[model samples]
Target: MKVGVVTFPGSLDDVDAQRAVRLGGHEAVALWHGDHNLQGVDAVVLPGGFSYGDYLRCGAISRFSPVMTEVVEAAGRGMPVLGICNGFQILCESHLLPGALVRNQRQKFLCLDQRLRIERTDTPWTAAYAEGQEVVIALKNGEGSFVADTETLDRLEGEGQVVARYLGENPNGSLRDIAGVSNERGNVVGLMPHPEHSVEELCGTGTDGLGFFALATLAAEVFA
Candidate 1:
């Protein structure tokens, strides 16, 4: 399987996401934010960073990038799309996922090894994880709090769209401690934590995050 890792201006973890893809036994394709083409990749990953300098808001400017046009279309076709950190914000801004990412309750940037419980394993990116399993990953962000209306939150929870939740203390004060979520089709996922940074034991928190990339390989076969 070939996974495209998009590199937007100010993307800090695009290369790390590419490395994770390779370590998961798949090819990684470099994608440019300014390109409207997807280059025929099987899946797409929007890595973490302060895109467009977080100008108006986190991910506000980058959501209008040329590459996101292709990404939104591909995701609509059931192509697996994973967004991390600032990428998560982009997904929300693009309306690919529900809710909005707001500033932390304490109004401060946070960096830590966050423990998240795998809530839904049916998504293409989470199939390798067991339900209720806990995994630690690197998390760093200022506006990571997930907010949604009560009805929407209830609908997401009722439909099993909530993918992961913070296990310990809520680092960013996300509503319901949501660390991740998936679209109705389960192909598009937005996660606040940096799973790419956790794929290598020597570098990040641990290798627990490798499951996300590993399971994505099967999505190509399933969707093909």
Candidate 2:
């Protein structure tokens, strides 16, 4: 399967994401933020970065990128889309996912190896993980706290839309310790951690993050 990784002007992790895709046994297709084509990739990944210099709020400007136009359409048609860190913010800004990522409770930028518990495995991005499985991945962000209305929060919990949660201490004060979430159809996922950074054991970050990308092949088959 070919996974497309979009690169915005301020994108910092697109190259790492492409490498992770290859290590996960898939071809990585580079897509430009200014392009409207998806290049017929099986899935898409919105890598983390301070797009548009994080002006007007994180992900607020990047959501209007030309590539996102295609991404939003593809996601609607059941194509799998994974958003990481700032990418998660873009997903919310684009209305592809519910809730908002606000500044952390401490109001400071955080960077650490975060422990997260897999809450659901039905989504394409998480199918390789077991429910309740715990994994440590790189997490870095100043605005990573997830917030939603009480009713929406209840609905997400009841429907199992919450994909992952912080295991130990809540690093960014995300509500309910939520670390990741998925759309209603489970094809779109937005995670606050950087799975791409933890794919190689040589990096001493462990291989837990690889599972997030390893399952990309199954997405085309299962979601089709």
Candidate 3:
């Protein structure tokens, strides 16, 4: 399986995302934001980073990139797409997933090992997890609060689209502690945590984040 990680201007975690994909036993394809194609990747990952310097809202500008044009089309056609942190914001800005990420309620940047409860494991990026499992991953952001209207929230809950939720604390004041969500078909997933940073054993953080990359690769196999 080959996973493509996109690199936009100011993208800070593309290399780490690529590393995690390789560690998960897949070839990592480097993708540039200016490219007008996907380069035949089996799956795509939009890593955490300050795209376009977070101008006019975190992911607003990057959502219009040429790469996103391909990403959106591929995603609509059922290609699996995972968005992390600012990437999550990009997903929302692109309307690939419902809801929006706003500035943290505390109005400051936060960095911590966040505990997230697995809510749904059917999504392409979450198949490696079990229901109700609590996993810790690195989370850092200033505008990571997730919000949506009550009706959409209800729809997400009713449809089992909420993928993960904060276990101990709602770090950014996200509604119902939502840490991640998936689209209707479960092919697109967006989250505010960095799973790539916890895939190493010596890092002392458990390899909870590795499941995403592993599952993404496994999903590619299944699709193949």
Clashing pairs in 3: none
The sequence of per-residue lDDT tens digits that candidate 1 reaches over residues 67-118 is: 9999999999999999999999999999999999999999999999999999
Candidate 2 C-alpha lDDT tens digits along 27-79:
99999999989998989999999989999999999999999999999999998
What lDDT score goes with residue 43 in model 1?
Answer: 90
TM-score of each: 0.97, 0.97, 0.97
Residue 166 CA error for candidate 2 (Å)?
Answer: 0.3
Task: Give a tens-digit lDDT track for model 3, residues 1-224.
Answer: 87999999999999999999998988999999999999999899999989999999999999999999999999999989999999999999999999999999999899999999989899879999998999999899999999999999999999999999998878999998999999999999998999998899888377989999896545656768
Model 2 deviation from native, Cα RMSD in Å: 1.5
Cα error of candidate 1 at position 71, Å = 0.6
- Please, what is the whole-model Cα lDDT of each candidate in the order they appear? 0.93, 0.92, 0.93
- Candidate 2 ranges with C-alpha deviation above 4 Å: 216-224
